[model samples]
Target: MDHEKVNILLVDDQPAKLLAYEVILKDLGENLVIASSGREALEVLLKTEIAVILVDVCMPELDGFELAAMIREHPRFQKTAMIFISAIQVSDIDRLRGYEMGAVDYVPVPVVPEVLRAKIKVFSELYRKTRELERLNQELEDRVRARTAELENSTAKLRESEQRRSMAIAAGKMGSWDWDWITGDWMWDEGQYRIFGVSPESFEVNPANVQALLHPDDVDQLRKAIAEFNSGTRAYETEFRIVRPDGEVRWCVGTAAATIDANGRVVRVSGVTVDITERKRAEERQNLLAREVDHRAKNALALAQSIVRLTRADEVKAYVNAVEGRINALARVHTILSLSSWQGAELSKLIDEELAPYSLGGQIRLAGPEVQLLPATAQTLALALHELFTNSAKYGALSTRSGRLMIAWQAENDRLTLTWEESGGPLVRTPKSRGFGTRSLLASVESQLGGQAQFDWRAEGLLCRLEVPLTRKTAASPAPGKFDAAAAAELQRASG
Candidate 1:
């Protein structure tokens, strides 16, 4: 629990200033790093766990502002606090820019040693408090885990005790009978007569009587299970159908254990039998329900696949190759959804996989932050990328060997911006008419992703931009429909 060894980073172009600050804060008991240049400061920050950075604004080759910007851009260094020290007077705009670049405070130079030391102490105390809180939280978690383990152990013991009590009560209420092979005799308990629905005085203990009471189909299995138990090869647990003298059939569960004489010869086999007709019926019902559920799920998936296949069928032979290809795309989306437990898809990876074929040969470039997409967003984006790839392959950048395309996206403050740029295709001119592919992309982006789509047909190439809000992504999604005929016509007319 040593709180005195907190790490601090000091960046200044002047050696004298560095030494002066270090001397003033010597009593604070911190490990202070002094760098004479911004580059040197960055090197120090990279190698160490820096609690705070005190930087000089004016320096050669990456000044404080530039260095701060670099730090903010890096995900690992995003949370590091920066304090700027400058001798020159800074305007309101300059101060605002510093704050925008993630500077937490500004210290004027020709510095006061006492005031600087006190500021350093305040930051050091805050860092210590954060570390202390983290330690306490970890301790609390460990205690909770121990308590949970004890509760689980107690619950297991209680379940085991309950099971033993249930088994004893079941044995007492039911009945048991035994057969002595060596003595060639049979015996039955009082409860056994009750189970068979017979009076003890009317029944005689004999093999013939027992055989007559058992259902014919279960006689062989019942004998086999008993024989296996006597040979010490298996525990005796068997289910069979039994018939009463009055001709009523009932399901029964029988369990037996073997008794061996002194010579290691089987003396007798004894066990309990219980009526299990209700239990058997319940099991059958459960099995039927399970099969029905499995069948329905398969049919639903097949129906969805059929809908996708039919909708894309018209464009298959003329624009693409076959209906199977479109179906496969839909299947791939389904696979992604399944792998994520139907949660959604990762937007960047989805785009990369869908565009990989055309992206080869430097025809396309992709860049984006990692963001998860809802099911609707995933399907819409997949279809849009498909149309873009198809159009490019037929007449745009992907048609020529020398063409290039850049597909990039960025997420900023909960908004996502995606851009598609093309180059080195046929001489750029306005399209004569809007096509099905163009219309699909626009409608899908707007309605499915809750986004805006803009098309720019510049002389250099065709550029498409989309902007979307990230909040619309959800776990459960509604079905996405196809683009209307009017939108398709509009795209065709604009292009023509």
Candidate 2:
């Protein structure tokens, strides 16, 4: 049925009759094979596809009925149409026999050329349509096979991509979620249940249920974010706290986008979330440290300025030395305070640092129980001690090699009293004027340390006493000093 060419076999004993049959069907544009005997016709049938066979009923050796029977016996030609042609009158019995042999039509001899051509034309058209239908069916089968392969390949690739995505999400501890806003339906993946500290089988994922799990302080903010998302004013990227079932609060960051319907209404929301509690805590600690450093740096700079302003000397170099020494004394106390995280400094350690530069083995003696002073108080006290030591080295007990000095302190009635006594040195007299060093010492003791200091010019040497509350109020941050021309002139006169 799918042959490239259709053949019509014409078998007869007379060549003239075969020629006449060819002429009649030649216009139909089909291959016409002529056979003088049934044997030749059989050969043509075996060699090519024959659409219709026209045979002479009275052929020699083999007749039309015999040839038709033989053709029908072959399974290959089972559907081949046969038309019998004869000049002799055909009886009903012979016609019935031809019909049984699969003859499609009986044409009497002296057959009308038009009738013959019409019959062949019908079979030719039927053969062409059958072959076309077979070709189309084959093409359709090929297409179905190709399409099935493509679909299978696509399904395999989709499965692989899903596997990779699942692995990535699991490794990152990320959770996915989906919400049907209109229906209040929520779906959470396995990771989400773990992050929320809940069993997925029993947890209700609606808005009210989820909100109940949120930290009380964060509930309002989260609601506002959701409201904005629902109003189409913002995409859902937010961070908030959730109180897990275990009573532990954790930080979570999530992002979601709404799916819009054809009517431009939000139908669903879906996104991913991650736990960020550790990161949040780390950020808080970092901020606190930064603030502490800023406060300390500002305080140190202000204290240095105050020292520079109070220092006086005849030359700039002398002034620099005085300021630097006082600042170093402050630095030494800071070093000790840093060990205690700036909580406080030990009083005895502070005294040792200030006296380190001028400590004479037998001359400088100190006695006091270890007491801690607040940071601001310790820094002020260190500067005062430095000034006192510098004056003693220049004009008091330590001015002479044989002079001796004793420093002692004791706490009583919630207050501390410190005595500075010098002996075996030149007689002391009250000075007619106070120098910058003496004024600075007095100002720092009262204004910075909230204490009182007194000096008695004794005949043997100078004696000083300091009285301060055991727990004096922490001094406020000092205002930065302005080292302008007027201040410089005032300091110079004080130095003189």
lDDT value for candidate 2? 0.81
User: What shift in Å separates residue 128 of candidate 2 from its native position after superposition?
Assistant: 50
Worst 10 residues of 1 by lDDT: 475-484
Best candidate per TM-score, number?
A: 2
TM-score of each: 0.36, 0.52
Local distance difference test, per candidate? 0.74, 0.81
lDDT of 1 by residue, 272-325 (tens): 888777778899988965764454355335434433433433454653453344
Q: Show the colliding residue pairs in model 2.
A: none
Q: How does residue 68 of candidate 2 score in lDDT? A: 91
Q: What are the runs in model 2 whose C-alpha is more than 4 Å off? A: 1-205, 213-235, 242-251, 257-295, 315-317, 411-415, 470-472, 476-496
